[model samples]
Target chain A: MADKVLIYSRFPKTMMARFAERFELLDTGGKPAQDVFSGNELAGIRALLTAGGSPLGAEAMDRLPKLGAIVCYGTGYDGVDLKAAAARKIAVGHSPGANAASVADIAMTLMLAATRRILIADQYVRSGDWASSRQSPMMRPQAGMPGRRIGVYGMGEIGRKIAARCAAFEAEVGYFSRTKHDLPYQYFPSLEALSDWCSVLMIAVRAGAETQHVVNADILKRLGEDGYVVNISRGSVIDEKALVAALSDKTIAGAGLDVYQEEPHAPDALTVLPNVVLSPHIGGHTLDSHVAMQNCVLANLTAFFAGRPLPHAVKTA
Target chain B: MADKVLIYSRFPKTMMARFAERFELLDTGGKPAQDVFSGNELAGIRALLTAGGSPLGAEAMDRLPKLGAIVCYGTGYDGVDLKAAAARKIAVGHSPGANAASVADIAMTLMLAATRRILIADQYVRSGDWASSRQSPMMRPQAGMPGRRIGVYGMGEIGRKIAARCAAFEAEVGYFSRTKHDLPYQYFPSLEALSDWCSVLMIAVRAGAETQHVVNADILKRLGEDGYVVNISRGSVIDEKALVAALSDKTIAGAGLDVYQEEPHAPDALTVLPNVVLSPHIGGHTLDSHVAMQNCVLANLTAFFAGRPLPHAVKTA
Candidate 1:
């Protein structure tokens, strides 16, 4: 007799095989085709493996009467109903520090891309107007990494990692957090102070109610001319309207963004700005990081079935 | 009495006045109306303040018989005849480290820009076809810094600086130099070995007889499917045709280039490739670097007139 596993999301086949070898894996593989409560779909399920982006509604939770635990295969558990899980005495676990390296890499990449205008130059050369456009003497020379200041807002794991990478470019690094960590960096008491101190301001905080619109119009004003902003955390951290105004007025230099408030639909104003850089919210979604997240899911499942403490729990809502 | 100072290139108005107050400055300040020597420009010139890019031919050297020293404003002294300077007992001094930091910064900038596709993403958003493009998933996640391998060729000052910065990203840093340096990071004995090891390769060496076509077809093949190449050094260091072949064949992932074999003229094949990132040669030509170069010119001039040792000298051709 083996413990039964319920997978709520489609995962890599490698991980699925590994899970099957360990338990009598009842792979539900994808979103419930009809309703989640279809005949015996959730019966004998001891644990559930889930992910973000897909809605795991209360109705789905109600079907899993035997579900003892739920594991999120990502840092965020936005799709999971934590309140509902607590009501059912389901131990919910989320993967932590699994995607830090990937997210940090993207942040640094965004900063570099936004600052250097890589895509712009490439397009110029490719479009066959290289001779007329580039030969002009008045064109400003490409500025490099050294002597630039980079400010990291929210000095948590991702922010610290980004700060280290920026420092490698010989850029002076500063950061702001709620509590001062005894690190060897110049800590700003506030985000505005950090923005004022840097040419590139990178956001690497969590995306939730607490950090929404932290980088508003006032902060953009302080970032000033010849400054760039990069956001890889969450779109909610910045006021999109403020960012557009600043870029339009040339109050700040530029921006590199990977996340947005509405998501998949960035502001038309931001999209049109010559100085701004944008990417889809694909940070921390690398193949390597995905594997890590899945592994964390497996570990949480194994531990919970053995009556062990959940690896990563959401203490609060 | 002040010694006669020949101002070889245009200078800022304030800088010229400062020089005039310091010495008996000659005003060959604007673009020359005719040949520099034919117009009696060098009749009594004892010291020369030189410009970069334009060549100082044999004719100019012949007329400036009494010229005791040539103070080069930038790094490259290809314009000046070093042998002639040595024969005439005219010491030649140049600014070396002044642009090292700037060049290093540009190299890292190119690397980041190229690898992350910042400009491409920006253009995608701006072109009003963001929805169409979002259907295809991106290659790498955003802001993931750690566990990347970065290889540096020609491990000089700029290369070393780039290595330090890449390390800050928590990348596994490696290098291939003429001789193995006692560096903290791993040193690949050959270019092939380094290419095999690194996902990203940065070229930061001098461009001359010694390092021509160092990154050719063979090395590109070794870099393979997952690898990226960034050239901040001279374009002559890479074989443009071979690079285009690799890129077109999809043998390697992509490239970020700031230099080309032909100025203002890049290969059509490279420009057309979606993976390749291109830029006009402005890596070391930033405002900050230009100001530094001017200051170096001042320093070299001051030193030569005062009979002090030159800080940076071109020892070889």
Candidate 2:
């Protein structure tokens, strides 16, 4: 008998077809698989496949009594309640290092965008400024990143990648992590100290209760009037209200934000602020990256059901 | 008696006062003495304190027979004919390296602007797209730059500085120069070879007959489909017409230009293009850079007249 599988998030048909080849696959089309777990839709389902950012709450875990394995299809498994899943002896696994390069790419892009004033210059050109150009005739040339200091908060894999890029720009790269790494660049004991030293600060730490508001009002102030801040990590990592106020008052030079505190429904004030550059949260959503994340999920699922060591077991319990 | 000094460029009051105290300063209120060079005005001036970009042809040099020293206020003596100046035994000095850091900063800014999609995203928000945003809602997360290869055309001081900035962004930097330097990064032998390897190429070489259109159609095509070109050097360094055609056809990714073939007026086709970013010729004209350049020019003038070594003498005939 095949292991019954329920997919809770969107995936390419190719991946779904691959899953169907081995398991008793059921496509949820990103709908909440409450029926499958509640024993109403289908019984004896042994596997659960879900992507990151899906709501797999305690109630959802309690319903899936027969679920032997739960595989997260992306890097962050914050949405799922790990303790509940662990209590049921359900093996939880999440994909890791799948989207590092792509996320790193986006981080660099946001930093560059914030520093260069690219968006502003383009709008000036587009608003029929050719004949009577406001910026062209008497524009101040932009300050580039060379000889500038760049600070990275949370020197994880993504943070390290960003640091390498910042280093390439001839910026003195510094970092603030919980524990110091054996690296040549200077390590600040705290984010506030790091922010004070850097003209451009990039937040690349994970988002959680402990790491939430890592870049709070105090650290923001330390960034100073000529400093820019970029967040490519998680929305919960920064205090969006404080960021908006800082930007409005010109306490910070600018911000380039990929993820916000409340995403999709970003604060209306942030969108209106002239000093901020905003992007919809899509850091790890590249076609190449998505495929990589999906492959990892599939590999983990395959190993779990085969009674072998899973490739990326989350160790949630 | 002290040599009669003619001031042509507009400088700050503090700088002006400094020059006045040192020489018999003749203030022309930012206008280059077209009449004075034609023997129509200021006929008895023994020394010329002119800025670069002043048209000093053979006739102008011939008219100024008493001109013992020609101290240009900036680099690039293309405006002042070196052959003519040398024939008249005029000591031509220019302010070099004074504004290099500022210009380098702007170059990195332009490159970052082109790579990061700053203007495009800014317009998306400013155009009331957030509330009724089509791109944001259905968008897969986009990628930005990290681990991208950046090519610098000239490995001079400015080019080296730009490389340093590229490093900060985690960019793998390479450069093509006539001779190799003992730098930390990789060096390419030719522009074509560099174009083949780099996604973003920066032009920072001196502009003249020998170096004109160094980035031509062939090299641009070699930069390939997803490449971006940034020109912060002289406008003559790039083939503007070819760049426009490439941008029109989407041959390369995009371009960020600060200088143009014609000052004040850019090509209408280039101005209208969506993919390219344009700036008026303000690459090295920042307030800080201007003051620095002026000081350098003053120092060159003071030293030349005092029979001290000229600070920034232009190597010319």
Candidate-wise lDDT, in order = 0.73, 0.73
Worst 10 residues of 1 chain B by lDDT: B135-144
Candidate 2: misplaced stretches above 4 Å?
A: A1-55, A63-74, A90-92, A124-147, A168-170, A285-295, A305-307, A315-317, B1-32, B35-56, B59-79, B98-105, B125-149, B164-174, B180-189, B285-295
Q: What is the DockQ of each candidate?
A: 0.45, 0.30
Model 2, A37-57: lDDT tens digits are: 456644566678886556686
Model 2, position A177: C-alpha lDDT score = 92
Q: DockQ of candidate 2?
A: 0.30
Per-candidate TM-scores read 0.82, 0.81
Model 1: lDDT equals: 0.73
lDDT of 2 by residue, B65-134 (tens): 6776777765666667788777777788887876776667667767655655555555554565643544
TM-score of 2: 0.81
> Ten residues in a row with the worst lDDT in model 2 chain A?
A130-139
